[model samples]
Target: MKKIAMTVFLSTAMILTLPISSHAGHANHQPQESKELLYQDMLMLFLLPHIDQAVHDFYAKQLTASPVVYPYQVEVKKAERVGGSRSFHFLITLETTPVVGPHIPVGTDRLRFEIDPTLPGQVKLIQFEHLKSHELPPRWRHMIRRPEAIR
Candidate 1:
């Protein structure tokens, strides 16, 4: 929980500071973001809340004796602004492996977000795809069935 809180705080700070950072070159110059850059930024903001959950889910499925580690990677494959609002569409790929499975899991999830720049706290997830491409191992399956097995 603390990790997630810290991640959210950091991501929020980074996003909020991007405009300032980009315009730091000259006092009179204001940075203008290209459409692509804006889209990428919006896509990143959209994915921020999900990163910790993805990591947690990835670690929970592992049945190995080795210590669990951050096992997932998220990549933004494509991003586009929708209409004129601060809404965006995204295509993201998440790659990881199940804790006990021998196979690698790769999932492509589509996401859409509506961001109100003026009211940053009102950012909303318009759409989400919970993508999972691999079956759990026997041990994990058993643990999943018995909720108490989860610590």
Candidate 2:
């Protein structure tokens, strides 16, 4: 009789602990779904541009001229939707060549671009701060015109 009572008690404890363990496993996975949703929203709103092909081609030429300073990868760090516009803050990592001495590699020129959805394919280079450009890339300079300059 004692043995039966001991087995029942152990089974009940194991069943109760199983749910707690399962819940913890589920909690860790929930955030991944939310992040994926956010990424989808960003792609739909900000990155769905046909003109990106031209932009990529332009960047390629610019990088060839100044490989050490030009950004190798442009990653959208954050995308926020506001009214009819979406603000995309990008992190541009400029790939620096390996130094001969004890020089450490560094990245500069982080750019933020704000695009208005209402204007269709119109993208405003809202803020180009933190950049030290001697001359704007020919493709971008010729393609994207400044809002202020438009008469």
Candidate 3:
């Protein structure tokens, strides 16, 4: 009878503590809005420093025979949450220069950033696809061939 009473009392105490502990645990948790804002700030800051390096590396890797240097720009095309993961897509353009050859025409690529859920505010580059300048829209294609056309 004593053992049964002790077990019942312990179970009751454990159950009573669960709610209090859970509430306390959640007390310091930030709302999703603030968490997302933090994530965005982290993402922007992380990408800004690495964009130039990534562009240079891509060119060096893709064109091993002749290392070419071209003015490059990265434009964030979109950022969206798909399923449980956040994704950032960027249009990377390496503008044509006076010395650009037929083989190394104006370069364009789609850079994709897949958020690493485990790392919270970090991202992994999932794709870096080379896009032909001709594949773009007519106006964009023209702009690639003649950059001054738009300006």
Candidate 4:
């Protein structure tokens, strides 16, 4: 719980300071973001609340000998705004390193989400796919996704 709170706090702090940081070079003039950049920023803001949950879910399924380390890594490979629309497609890699055992990476995941441009907070997952499987943990409830569903 503390970890989650800290993660959320740090993320929020980073976001809150973003505008301040950007103004270092042009203190007198307000910066304008490009269309693509704006879309990307919005997409990220929408994803922030869900990020911790996504990481938790990934680790839950990974199963490990110990309480797999908290705060796994997430790499954003792609964040597409979907043709000037509110819909977005994301490719992310979530990895974990065990504290006392071999690591069982969660591999990459592809996600698609649709949101009302006006209300980016309300997001619906259009698609969610784990790129590949990982090693089973001490007692992972192995569940195999259908081959047809993988793609």
Candidate 5:
């Protein structure tokens, strides 16, 4: 009888505290994590459009049309929340090279992008400099088509 009473009391106490502890944790850090994820989203949004521009600037005067830019690397310069507001911003640079029959170009480009979630992002071409390169095996290259490309 004593053992049963003790067990029941402990279970009741634990059940009662479950929500309070959960609420405490949620109240403390969950919102911050959400804000961090918002910054991450801002980073992605800032990166997408600048990629083609990077390719264009890298191959300027070389290719009459914009070649497919293979984004070899991504660098996030800044990602943070706006001052006392629900806005976010990201400054990012994308390293890219033109597709030249699997040969690396003379140098790659660093395309800088800045985005204010309050407004549309803008594009800028920073530079073209030679960076060391390595090759990686195709992870998902098997999903291939002959003439056309997948978006």
Candidate 6:
């Protein structure tokens, strides 16, 4: 009787634990790599059509005014694909200017840019509400307008 009772108890315990172990195994499963590729595709589609002459014109003006620091390094921070479209948030790090004159010093600026699939390829500058005191050049300010407001 004692032996039978012990065996029954062990069997019930094993049965209860089996499902929990299986669930943990499922959690370790790898996500598909294709999801990332699909996201890139969506981003390209949304931006290519929305980026227009106005956007280019704005960048050109900035370049003309500040040829020394015209080009910016764009880093894509996050990208997501939803409903056949891609959205992206990126960071732009302005190249530091070389120190000039006796008292002036070179400075660096970092800006965040957001691109929605609705306006693909076109990036809009978001005002850093937290850093309201940071001063950016006029050209940079003009370039920060939304796609619809560019013209």
Candidate achieving the largest TM-score: 5
Clashes of each: 1, 0, 0, 0, 0, 3
TM-score of each: 0.35, 0.29, 0.35, 0.35, 0.39, 0.24
Tens digit of lDDT per residue, candidate 6, span 1-151?
A: 9999999999999998885434345667887779756765554444332232223333343332221222212123444443453424443322222112231222333333455445544576542212112234443544333433222
Q: What lDDT tens digits, residue by residue, belong to model 1 across residues 54-119?
A: 445444454233212222334554444545565553234433222333433323344445554544
Worst 10 residues of 3 by lDDT: 91-100
- Predict model 5's lDDT versus the native: 0.48
Q: Which scores better on lDDT, 3 or 6?
A: 3
Pull out the clashing pairs in model 4: none
Q: lDDT of all the models against the reference?
A: 0.47, 0.39, 0.48, 0.48, 0.48, 0.38
In TM-score terms, candidate 6 sits at 0.24
Candidate 2 runs further than 4 Å off: 1-72, 84-106, 131-151
Query: Per-residue lDDT of 30-143 in model 5, one digit per residue for the tens?
Result: 434587567655655556556666555544544333445442334444444435466455445555554443443423445555556455344443444435322323642332
**RMSD for each model, in Å, please?**
21.5, 13.3, 19.7, 19.9, 11.3, 15.4
**Where does the lowest 10-residue lDDT sum fall in candidate 2?**
92-101
lDDT of 6: 0.38
Residue range 31-138, candidate 3, lDDT tens digits: 567875566556555664444455555554333233233333344566766555445433222222211344344455566666545544555666666564323344
Which ranges of candidate 1 are over 4 A from the true structure? 1-46, 50-72, 82-108, 119-122, 146-151
> Candidate 3: lDDT of 141?
42
Task: Give per-residue lDDT, candidate 6, residue 117.
Answer: 43
Give the per-residue lDDT digits (tens) of candidate 2, residues 1-151. 9999999999999998885434345544644458766764564345324223323333343433212222223444555655544454332221122111122221233444555554545554444333333333344344223423211
